[model samples]
Target: MKGILCTLLLLLWMITGCSNNSASNMENNKKLAEAVKQETEMPLEMPTDFNFMVSFGYGDVTKNVIDTYEGTVTKDLIIKGSATAEILFTADELRDIYDKMKTIDIMGPKELSKKGNCFQTPSNEDLWKVTVGGETKTFSWTDQKCGITEDANQLRELRNYIQHMVEGLEAYKTLPEAEGGYD
Candidate 1:
């Protein structure tokens, strides 16, 4: 009878351990799912009339702000337009492009341009090369050890940056309209 009880107890313990592990795994999976959903839901907004330059290189990431300096070309008058926030990136981010050029082999030379606005390349490889206005910038992987590794943190940062630019552009677009003119 003692032997039977001991065996039964051991079996119960093993079952409990397995169940706990499964529960932990399920929790982790749920968290991951939520994170992914949030990321996907993040919006990428761009201005109606602006450009952004981003660079993801080994040195520094650079984002050049570019905008059309519109001027009213009347019969004999030229009025300078206002400045707007184009796009922003760092130089280091641009350099990363060369480091992982191999992964971008599938990309074509067709520039990702938008009508009357800016351009943003689709996420490819581990790099993000985007252009706004007439300027261009790059975004490369920071963690070399995780190169090619689709880490959630890296993705989140990239997404945040893009989203930020979108918001800036959106705000910029409204500025001129609100003033009823760009002077």
Candidate 2:
């Protein structure tokens, strides 16, 4: 009887030891998967010559931002099958946008799309994207209400700011022809 009891204790010890080993292996595998994803992803950069780009759909009436700038900006818009319009956009604006966006944690994977049931929630939602250093980060909210989380306010502000920037373009033409426009 004593021998049988001793054998049972040894078996239990072995089982616990094996489970701990399994847990460690799982943690290592998770880390490896994250490293692989980072290594394999394609890099995105904001091109210096990126004079014009569509901000995509986030507004009610106007569909896209149009560029009146000549050279690569014009050609790219044409290729995208859009009728370009002359508007005020400057490197300063881009830099400002970059500064605002760099504060958001966009280095990790993020879900940019959200779905809502019409019956469940009658609220309107919009997705905003800002591209910098060739990378685009997206934020979406229902109407202008952002969300219930702490981070939602920051997101709402950024969205409102971008909306203002895009809307502000309508007020002026060619940015008063600054020294070398893009400079």
RMSD of each: 17.2, 9.6
What TM-score do all the candidates reach, one by one? Answer: 0.28, 0.47
List model 2 lDDT by residue over 1-183, tens digit each: 999999999999999999999999999999998896675343344346333233333233223443322311111122233344445557788656545644654334444433443332323344454444455545554442333333544555665675567556654333233222110
Predicted candidate 2: what Cα RMSD to the true structure?
9.6
Cα error, residue 110 of model 2, in Å, equals 3.1
CA lDDT, candidate 2, residue 67: 34
**Candidate 1 structure, TM-score to reference:** 0.28
lDDT of 2 at 6: 95
C-alpha positional error of residue 27 in candidate 1 after TM-score superposition, expressed in Å: 4.1
Q: What is the lDDT of residue 4 in candidate 2?
A: 96
CA lDDT, every model vs. true structure: 0.39, 0.47
lDDT of 2: 0.47
